[model samples]
Target: MDDITEINTKENRQLLYKYLIKMYGKEKAKELMFKHKDNLFGNNSLAYSLGKRSIVFYCLYFLQDYFVPKDDNTVRDLAPVHYDIWRELEDIFIHHTHDKQQFILPRGCAKTSIIDMALSCWLHCYRESIYTVVLANRELDAINFVEQTKIALQTPYIKNTFGELVQPRKRTVNKLELELDNDTKIQAYSSGSSVRGTSYTSSKGKNRVTCFIADDYISEADILSDESKEKKYIKWQKEVEEAGDDPVYRNGKLIKSGTKFIVLGTPLAKGDFIDSIKNDPEYKVFHKSVVPFDPDEYFENHTYWQKFKEIFFDNKRENPLQDAKEYYEANKEYMAFETIWEKYSHFELAKKYFNKKLVFMQELMCDVDNVGDSWFKSNRTMPMKEIENHTFIKTMLTIDTAGVKNKDAKRSDYFAFVVGSLADNDFKYVRQAHLRKFKEFDEYIKHVISLLKENEDITHVYIEKNTYNGLDVDAIKSEMVKHSELMKRDITFINEMQRKNKDDKISTIVDAVNNGRIIFCEERVEQSFLDQVMSFAGQRFSLHDDAADCLSEFANRIDEIEIMKNITTIPRGWLF
Candidate 1:
């Protein structure tokens, strides 16, 4: 009986060894063989425990693979970059999801893809019916993003999960609506299109809103002007932001996703949401650059990653172009690659491309410094501290029209006009500030007329002949002519010739500001304007500070109260 039992035990051991050999291979199986050498080895041993764990792991992995399709485009299982952004958004989803926060990212980075996938997953997988509104600066951008998202969903892997569950359809050219099985639907709308007035009614329409994404609401050039474009941008931001109100929690999240609005573009030359965020104390902004830190390891691990860095040379200081070349030579790979070091390179780029001071405040760092060799300082631009409460008269207005770029939405300073006094140093609170950004040109014309009516103390109006491709100047004159027929007041629209250098004019104005001759409105005007004013580089104005430019030109063109020389010269000291 003992011999028969021994033979049966040997047979069982042989079968187990064969299975182990097949699973773990010969070498690993040999290691396991010793683990099971003891009579009690099967109960407790390193190899025995590892064998058990491996089996359990494989079983779980197999189950997950079977249930979850290989192409699950869900946010949770997105690519690494998408996953990182999703993680940032996940916190927002649970807490501040309803609050409108602007998101700015560069182009061609699959931002729309991630957003659409996230929305779809949030809706179908989580079974949450969300009222999501996706807006773009133009109808084309909005349509393209939505269509791409729909196509992504149609991928074989994505279809396997929620294909029959939710049907993605393009109800219109500018509208993409998806119907879910649970009677929950998502409707997409474009800000540039007529969808602004579209009804937001729902079955349970008790203030229903889940997400709002405004992608590339403004281009770089549009945001830098002091015309209607700036105004339109501000207005759209306010209206779209207010659209996401939820009576339930009274908390709705609004996201502005675009490269220009956030970062990855030239520093704003005019006032923008980015400027507002930097200036507003109540709004705590969390800005994270794409590659905020050294991607040495990441780049080393994945060499295909390409980075674009811009370097600048200050010709005023050293040979700027030469300095840049040498700098590039010393740090060739790092210079060409986007990394933590590239941010420093961006500072150089800002200095050379735009103005050093502008980039410093708007890009490299958030600290707004007034000290620099700027057009304002060189031109003796004055501060309100010196000119405040001075008796003066005869206010004139100058308009910088931007009608061409502002065709999509009128949220830009396309028509930036400054109303100030030429004789009276006492300018009435910087009133004639008009930013045009509405669907209709008539709205802008009316706004400008209203400004004119309010500031009745004005004697003359000067419009830049080339403002808005010169056509706008003509349009304004035509509009004024039409208004003359209706109103008894005689307001003449005169065009200014661009014979002199605007930079020299700007430089002269800068000298005035620095000499404490020209004063700015403390309450109404933003420090961003001042920062922009003081940071005006000698020539390449970049595109953000048009209002400041208008203010500078208006300030410079008007004769000073008195020629006060030698106020404060930059003390000469060290030459290293």
Candidate 2:
């Protein structure tokens, strides 16, 4: 269900039609009904038909029933953002401005249903463009848009206002394509599908594929790799833009504004297709996040946000989401955040997705700094002030080993290791961490032994039972045995197999970091380790997850190792 479009419908529409008949004669009454419909909102079809603003009038009058609500309590009205997009679309179809445009929208704003779907129907009804093509990342999504357009054309007001636009007998109406009565063909295609021969010949003239509406064309596959990203740009150049008549300019004036490429989507990735268009000079861009104000200023030192997160994310509370909604609705003005659309524009709705802040930012705010899902937040990991004199019951080293698979490969996974200790309280402290290439095994071992000496009470060394199994453990033992200083303490070596599901194994770290159970000493931990740990966008999307893997192993095994030691439950290393 959608938020009903808030319109001025205080006056009865059917009763007003009757009044129009009484004021004027029957013929003029019908004319006045067409002219002054739905309180008019200062619009009438008689005056609207003469000018280029037919799109707006049609939407206000014909699509009124579709948007306006029956409930008087629903305060969701059409805001300025809606009219701004309507005028921009009018500029494209009627006024002939820059043909290419992109609308970067917050997710819940209904401007898209007007700009992309309903406007396409108006274009077909007015016979504006001969051949129109709509596209999405998937063909089914494009078909969904086509379905909306088809439904709009058949609406009661639309059919009553403008007679049957669908072809009388031989209408080619289906899921993928629609042929209007005026011989205007509108087809839908997936992003990379063929739209080469998109042209139509009418009695007036032959027009190439002129109106191209691309709505949410960037998919996960499009932004997967560099080659796929390039292919998206190439598709726009060859299929959408190049397939139409090239716009001709004579004297700094656009003589022919050829094709319209309007993209409607929220930014998913940093340099995806919509972002690339935003940087280009030839196209016009309209970007609106959830609110019109600067996000930084609104969220800086936000007082109510923490309480909101606690209440919304609480699983024990019954109807926590509804209770959270009521709380926000009462105190929203005190927060003083203004959404573009009043209620439906994702104002306090971030509480619903507080756990996925990156998604909330990228989807609702169009801030693609961090693309999407983040398992571990870098800021959540606290840093200790000092760690020199702090004594630990037991310190263990976890090494994420990567064998030298191919020396000639452009890039190789790093051998990441983390040294962690269990304190007297239920807190695990990261003593040190570093990463290096697998080629320098000697250097890697030297660093490991050095860390061992630094953390002298190192009880055990654990390695994943993979590549560096048998001789590698022995080599480390030999190096430690050579040092007379390390001869006092006895160390255990274990080559253990890890769980196959990496994300499932690493799931505990999220709560551990968020709840302050784990701390990282910034002085000892390398920046590379922190970066890999934070940028691990779940399910192995990062270039190298060795550092994250090492941290996960270290965190999971801390309690088990303390149990093996049978350490006193009184102080540090009490199975933190």
Candidate 3:
């Protein structure tokens, strides 16, 4: 449906029935409006600007005729999806001490258009904020936010209601700052930059920044590691956040109200910036995922939806929804999961990243971690106590080095090691130990030797020589000489040239687990190792594969795995 632009419509439909009833009596008007609702619109008026009760109505009314430039900048109406959130936010902003609030919404949920520009206008229009500050990741973003606010002030409805917020002669609209005629200053700055001078001396008195808005302050590209995330966290906390104090003024014996702090962004990962705010008890958060309910729960047939989706997006067809019109009318409930916006339903949006489950989960669902089918059955693995009585014929260790040339690099991948032994004639492999860490040459070899010494039955060791060009293995071999006095003599160290595809090789571990041949010692296994093995799906599917790859390497050599338990064992490390 075309956007309901005429405020007459927003104003009319709300009271059209009452007006019609006054003219044609209650029964007739009710019959016409209910049975033929499409023909009716609300009663026309600008009465929503009266008071706090009109907060929701006023914002929803202003959603149309936005002058802000966001592609095809024409009058657009707020979708039904916007009402609930806006109502809730308007209530909080108008009548509560929302000291720190967050709106962690999905990527294209119109958060900026609604909250940053429109809701901000609401605050300024109502004189809720004295000095408002917008903080962003980049200088351009900061400028853009402030620019949009200025543009909103220029809109017809805004001007008619608020009456020229900016002063004509004053430095009203600069690149990053605007001083309204009401002595209200709204400015923008890049996050982490110095905001020590945000305090302004207005004619009335001293003006401390009473509002802080962090909007898209942290993007996906900003978060690389926990350390990088912490850097941003510190900047946000120190500069952008601390710039605004609670009270705008202090009387001799009384106090004023506090700042209304707001944050808006989608979370990138489990321990990212948004999650940090969520964990803090002081901040109030409202999170809205793109898909409200699991689409597959209601719509079980993928092939059917794929057909309708294909037809809809073909564009070549005269009508996109024509082919599946009946089907959609019947099954739209599956897609109607109370999305934040009705323009894109759950099924409609899912097609954008249908194959990329991890991306879909992170971006659309706000899921810190994606949960899906794993290659191995994590529940089937036996604990350490269950396998204590088993006799071991051969033991070995496999290493998956997080490829790095510099051992001393501050940020490098971990070296993951897996130690497992084959028991008697049964194909079962019992894990003895697992370790993963960022270690230098000496420390790495020390752990390797400890794994060897801890599990004395280990007769063979294999380490994938990735990027290190066998240098890591060679370093360990050279370092083993130092520990030769403490180590047993028969252990053989082999530099494994990892020419095979890791994704293909990991299948062996899955097969071993499915056959009940691979067992995990819960007490001895490292948590990271367990996480890797359980979460790994294959190729680019998981974040880390160190521990899983080490076990997969062990499975690769399973066929000829043998080590002379008493003698130079024949059934030792197996050959793949």
Estimated TM-score for each candidate: 0.40, 0.64, 0.55
What C-alpha lDDT does candidate 3 achieve relative to the native structure?
0.65
Cα lDDT tens digits for candidate 1, 190-260 = 54453343443445554234455555555444543456446645665566544544433224434432111
- Judged by lDDT, which candidate is best? 2
**lDDT per residue (tens digit) for residues 477-554 in model 2:** 788788887776777777876655565466557656543456788788888888888778755356667887889889
Per-residue error for 91 in candidate 2, Å, reads 1.7
**Shift in Å, residue 333, candidate 1:** 6.0
| Candidate 3 lDDT tens digits, 1-576 | 212455335444555555456446889867766664542322222232232344555554444455222355654456655666676666566556467888888887777877788777777766677788888878998888888888777655555445577654775678888788767888888865677757856677788788888887886555655677787777777766777765444564325567777888888766678888877788887877776677545334566666665554432354545555656667766544466565565555654433234555567777765323576653235667666667776778888776435565544556778787776544445475464564356677677777776777777888876656777766766776777654446777777578765655675466445434467787787776777677887655666666777887775564466555455656546754
By lDDT rank, best first, the candidates go: 2, 3, 1
- The C-alpha local distance difference test score for the whole of candidate 1 amounts to 0.45
Q: In model 2, where do residues sit more than 4 Å from their true spots?
A: 1-52, 71-76, 167-169, 201-206, 246-257, 306-333, 345-348, 352-354, 369-401, 405-412, 416-545, 549-576
Off by over 4 Å in 1: 1-84, 95-98, 104-129, 165-197, 200-208, 220-230, 233-238, 247-267, 277-284, 290-576
lDDT of each: 0.45, 0.70, 0.65
